[model samples]
Target: MRVLIVDDEPLARARMDALLKECADVDVVGSVGDGEAALAAISEKQPDLLLLDINMPGLDGKALAARLAHRTRPQVVFCTAYEAHAVHAFELGAADYLLKPVRVERLRDALRRVRQRLESQPREPVGWLHARVRGEPIRIALDDVICLVAEEKYVVAHRAGDQLLLDDSLRQLEETYPEHLIRLHRNCLVPANRLVGLKTLADGRVLARLAGTDFSPEVSRRNLPTLRKLLRVG
Candidate 1:
């Protein structure tokens, strides 16, 4: 994967470039001192990924990312020194972030995620699985989902009065659900719009209540914030 490093600090850029070289599949195609130069390089080189610093002299990284959000832009990984900007980086669809003075292992992990994104198939549209129910893919409406149950490797889509088995994993469904689904566990995905309430059980377990259903799905600790954010409670 071709990568472009965008940072004003000479030393930081150099360090990142050196670390990136350790990955056989990653090629440091260009290094620019500012966002303007980064933009120019993007237009010229069209690198596959960008290791960007949030602050710069000319155009800031956030502004640049906003402009490129809709374009055939390179996947972004914010290499900022500030922890405060982490949320902003996520909001911008950044593949990942590396705090300044990056660790080699972390950078390697970021690159691994970038590779996964590049290799994964484009998400099948919402409810596309309904058509494939009987060698004929069923078309389920997004609103029909009441809850999702994960068992082994498959997710079962439970609607208001019926259920359909989907051949997608929870991770893939997370990407597909986006604004519509809330993650209740590492293995389960729930419809965000269908969530009625969240409660902590006597056993010290968190569960999500789905609208129009008695099902209360378990919420893993790691996915709590994601669910809270989707429920507008975070």
Candidate 2:
């Protein structure tokens, strides 16, 4: 698995790199000294995993994670010197954590969990639910989601195979699928995993291409960086 280490201290980064080298399955692709560099590296390298520190200069780890949440959100294993951020870390759905001066055994355990989760999770299904739309029960699969367009009163669910009109608004959908989907515009949401490519139009508009579909969703300028990060493209 490709991995990136993000830490402010050089010693800590070297230590983590050494430990990661011990695991034959793990390839340490990049290491950065701050959150900004980490974001840049993540956008370029698209690592499968990230060993992040919670505190740093400029953008803190938590803030960086939040910003990158919509884009190439890698499985995160927080490595910090302090324990106070444990609750916050878990809330952000971090896979694991290791205190400073990380032990080899602990690092191994964390890697094990990362592998297990990646292998066990069903990426194809993308987590679906059977919900009543327009008083008719319909199965909404996440993988089929192309784009979500919002009207004044309700949001429209556009899927590759079918489209459904939903009573909930775009904001509600954003909250419901925080980890799985991301907002490209005020009225549209796209599956993060389905985002394959992005392009800037001559009109200065950004568009996102969905995997397995020709549909391109319009992206607002404010959210462009986040979208790019989520897609693991710089």
Candidate 3:
């Protein structure tokens, strides 16, 4: 398991690092003194878990966890001196909370739970897709797809300057390649990274604009909040 330690105290960071050296199957990716630095480390290292401190000068641990609520990676475990924030930490879906002056045994227990949680979670499917473009069978790289839309019995995959017909349904695509595609409507699945913006037309219909293509799919009202979260805008 990859871990990132975030705390304001230098001694606490060193102690945690020392204890982690004794633990098995663990890698310390990086250590940061504040939440802002933690965020940067998270983006860079993409650790599997975080050993976070609750109180700090800016962007405290709990607030940092809240900021990462929309994301699915890098689970959090609170390591704090105060016991008062236990309930709130758990409420934020923390894997575990350890008190200051942490023991090696307790740290190992937290790591065990995190490993179990990670193992039980379903992994997203990757690789290529076999589809047809103008009756020509070609394997499309999943990363090159901008969007997939369900039309009658076929699903159409849109790339930069091409469109291919697929046999799989939108729901199947959404479930199979969750890391690649996000649902904008019942009929539309757009790659999270490919999605760039949302445009409101004169008819008051919101459409999702994707990168590498001009095809804008209609966004449903039921999925508006999800779209906003994906775009990180309201």
Q: Mind giving the per-residue lDDT tens digits that candidate 3 earns over 1-234?
A: 999999999999999999999999999999989876786576457688999999987668887887655444578999999999999998888999999889999999999998997787643324577798677887876756778888888998876667899867888877887866788888888767556568999999999876555678899999988878855531
* lDDT, model 1, position 98: 89
Scored by lDDT, model 1 comes in at 0.74
Which 10-residue span in candidate 3 carries the lowest summed lDDT? 121-130
What lDDT does the true structure give each of the candidates?
A: 0.74, 0.76, 0.81
Which residues of candidate 2, in runs, are more than 4 Å off? 70-73, 122-234
What does candidate 2's lDDT look like per residue over 101-202, in tens digits?
A: 899999999999888877765234546644466688777766556677887776777765667877567777777778887888888887765565677899
lDDT ranking from best candidate downward: 3, 2, 1
| Error in Å for residue 106 of model 2 | 0.3
- Model 1 residue 5 lDDT score: 95
Best by lDDT: 3
For each candidate, give its TM-score against the true structure. Answer: 0.51, 0.54, 0.56
Candidate 1 local lDDT, 10-55, one digit each (tens) = 9999999999888778888899998757755764565779999998
RMSD of each: 14.9, 9.1, 8.0
Off by over 4 Å in 3: 122-234
Candidate 3's TM-score: 0.56
Judge candidate 2 at residue 205 and give its lDDT.
85
Of candidates 3 and 2, the better by lDDT:
3
**After superposition, candidate 1 runs with Cα above 4 Å error:** 121-234
